[model samples]
Structure formats: C-alpha cells, structure tokens
Target: MTTSPLSWLPLPSSTDRAEDEPASESDDQALDPVQLAALHRGRDAGEAAAAWVRSLSGRQENEDHALALEHAAAGIERASHQEVIPGGEGQLAEELRYALGADVLLGATHTGTVPDLAAGERMPLVAVCALAAAMPSCVLGDLPRELTLLAAELDAATAAGRAATTATGLAG
Candidate 1:
C-alpha cells in the first residue's frame, strides 16, 4: 500500500490525554487579566442564565413571566450600552445588544409568544441563534479574532442578565 502523506507523524499517545497530569510551566502562566476578567463575567452570566432557564422549564407561562422576560431583556440592553470598559475593551458589552435583540426575535418565533417564556429563559435561545448571524460578518470581513471573542462574551452576559433577573437566590 502507498504511504499517506500524514503517516510520517506519530499519533498522540494515551498519556497525552491524561487529566491527572500536572499542568506544564507554559500552561501555568496567567492569561491577560482583562481577558480573564471578561471571560469570568461571561461564563458567570451564561451559567446563571442557563440555570434560570432550567428552573422555569416546567412552569406555566403567566403575566409575571411576560413581565419578567421583558424586564430582563431591557436590563440586558441597558447593561450592554452602559457597562463600558477602558480602551473600549468591554467586549462582552459590545456584542450583547445585538445578540439580545436577535434573541428576543428568535425567542418569540420559537415560543409563539415572548411572554410565554420566563424572563431568564428567553435570551439564551436568541443568543444561540444570533451566533450564526454574527460569526459570518466577522469571518467574512476578516475581522480580528478579538471581535469574535467579544461577540461570544456578549452572549454570556445576556445569559447572566437573564438568570440574575429570574433566579431566586443568585445576584448575577
């Protein structure tokens, strides 16, 4: 049999996949503080929003649900515009408005009514759909990778805002 061009390289050993191994020195180095903080903010938000969505998964939609969703969406919009960071580095904030807005539209389409969802349940749905819309603009325009990160971060923030609004115990 003819050798494939890829055959010269060795395959990864099982040891490479070991999670118990200690981190390498290079891996120990800290990431940029700003980026780390931004990531935390995004992840916290996403987790919170996801949790809120879960909490309401079995509940019936009501007037309270409608109000809450609208409030959460509005809060996310406000935060997106107001939470500015230095050097315009608030990447999460920059993309949230667009994502949140698309989320509202998408949520409405899927749910048949925006008010049918709990406040915290609506945004993540829309945010996920918005990803396809946002990514192409960045990739096709040859935008910096940072912009894409920011867009993703914004999605996280939207989730957090929703969770914070709907969850009983968390402040997000």
Candidate 2:
C-alpha cells in the first residue's frame, strides 16, 4: 500500500496502539503553555503556506467573509461578550474597533512613534482594501481565506464607527 504524505509511516508494523493510555479530561484541560505556543507557531507556518498558494491564484475563490463577521459578532453576543451596548451588535462593533485600534497602536509602539498618534491613523481600511484589490488574480485567490478574515475584521471596525455615529445622531 502506498503511504500518503500526511500518513504516519506504517508505525514500524509492530507497535500496539491499545497499550497507550487515553488522556483524561482533566489532563487535557491542564495544557502547558509551551505546547500551546508550538501549536500557534504551526498555525503561523500554515499562514505562510497559504500565502505561497495565494501567489499562484487565478480567478476569485473568496469566502463569504461578511457572513463570518456576522457570525463572530453573534457568537460574542451569545457569549455575553459585551463592551458598551450592554447586550447587542453595538457591543460587538465596539469590540471589533478596539481590536483594530490595538493593531495600529502595536505598530506605533514598535516603530518608536508613540509620541505621534498621527502615525497610528495612517493604515486605514480604504488604503488596505485598495491595495488588496490591486494585487494579481493568483495572489488574490491564494489568499481567499486571509482576505475573508481581514474583511470580517474590517466589518467589525466599520460597525464600530457606525455605532459611534449613531450615538452622536450623525448616522441618521
């Protein structure tokens, strides 16, 4: 039998699987951070692999990312993950904006521009979406998943801006 790339190497044909003890639920909950960190590192590597595939992309294979945003926001509501609106989509909107602002702040902090808040506002969504849309077809297709995620994140950010405008009666 031919082995697939991801399949285990025949286990040396002699190892008994029944001898291994199953982990208890308590043991599962006690995951060490170091091991979790390795899993996160693997995910980071997978993103790089995705980027490589994206470079060879052609026609659009974009995921319905707007749905992902709505789902994520709904999940937050279900989990009582409120921020400002007590119990609603507005709270999710606020949370999303804060998350986006955090990324900008992180960039400013890294670039030693903490004293200049203007440095943080430079990376706006319009700029990014325009940049992505200008990319080659293969590059866009290869990154369908990442683009979906980015879109969801931006949707959240935009929703937050909407919420702020609503509060000020300017959105009406």
Candidate 3:
C-alpha cells in the first residue's frame, strides 16, 4: 500500500479515543484552574470595590453605590466565562495596559493623588478592570463610562480632602 502523508503520525490508541471526542456543553461549563482563579479574583475585587466606595463619606448609606457594585460583580462573573481568542496577543496587551491605567487611577484615590499604593492594595482594582476589559463592547456598554465618572469623583474628593487636611495642619 502507498504510504499516506499522515502515516508518519502515531494514531490514537483505544484509551486515547476518549480524549479526541468533543466535550459536551456541561463539560465546557466546568471551569479549569485558570478560570477558577479568575472567578475568585473577581469576587475579591468586587468586595474591595464595594468596601472602598463605602469608606467614602456619605456613600455608606447610598443605595445607588450598592446597586452599581452589584452590577459590576455580575458583569465580572459573566466576563469570566468568555473564552480568550487565540492569536490576539496585540489585543490582549492593549487591554492589559488599559486595565492597569484605569486601576492605577482608581487606586490613586486611596493614596491621595499618588498611585503609589502597594501591589497588593491595587491588585483587586486591576483584576476587576482586566475582567471588565475582557467583556465584549456590546455587553460592556456604559460600564467603562460609569467607572470613569466614578474615578473622577473619587479622585476629586480625595484631593479636596488632602487640601483640607493640609490647611488645617498649617493653621494649627
């Protein structure tokens, strides 16, 4: 018999047959280690974001902030289930840079105009933004804008607080 061009490759044995079969939908739903890690990170980030917002004056009793945090958490959970496309390295890099910048700006609110917080302190923000970035633009409608506004408000409030504290110190 003439040798086939594919003959050089070893064929799957009986035991390996199962590995070649397509996974069912239920099987696909099961998260691998990386997905599980992302989910946990998202949960932690949601908690951090909620706590940070609550720590702001008058925000602890704001129902709107609570609702926004809930929405963000839900979005992160949905985004976590999305599959990463192969050969999108450039897109991924851009997403990561954007996420980092967004998170750093948010983190600056906690550090009083300087994004010099420890990595651990900023990680949750980065994780949240990174997951948010992975979501499709159609699904992510309004979120980035909302987050930008929130960040601006928080940063302005922080700067004001710093100025007040400095004036009080100088006067005393």
Per-residue CA lDDT of model 3 for 1-172, tens digit only, reads: 1211111222443132254655433342433454333333333333344344223312223344334334433433333223121111213234334333453334324434433332333444444445444432311334234333433433343344334434444211
Model number with the top TM-score: 1
TM-score, candidate number 1? 0.31
Ranking by lDDT: 1, 3, 2
Clashes of each: 3, 2, 0
In candidate 2 the C-alpha lDDT for residue 105 amounts to 25
Model 2 misses residue 58 by how many Å?
38
Top of the candidates by lDDT = 1
Q: Candidate 2 vs candidate 3: which has greater lDDT?
A: 3
Off by over 4 Å in 3: 1-59, 82-123, 135-172
Across 1-172, the per-residue lDDT of candidate 1 in tens digits comes to 1211111212353122245544443343344555444433433343344444434432425544444445344434333222322223233334545534543433435445544443554455555334323432331332335433745665664555456445744333
Clashing pairs in 3: none
Clashing pairs in 1: 45-160, 69-119, 103-126
Residue 98, model 1: lDDT of: 52
What are the candidates' C-alpha RMSDs? 13.1, 19.6, 16.9
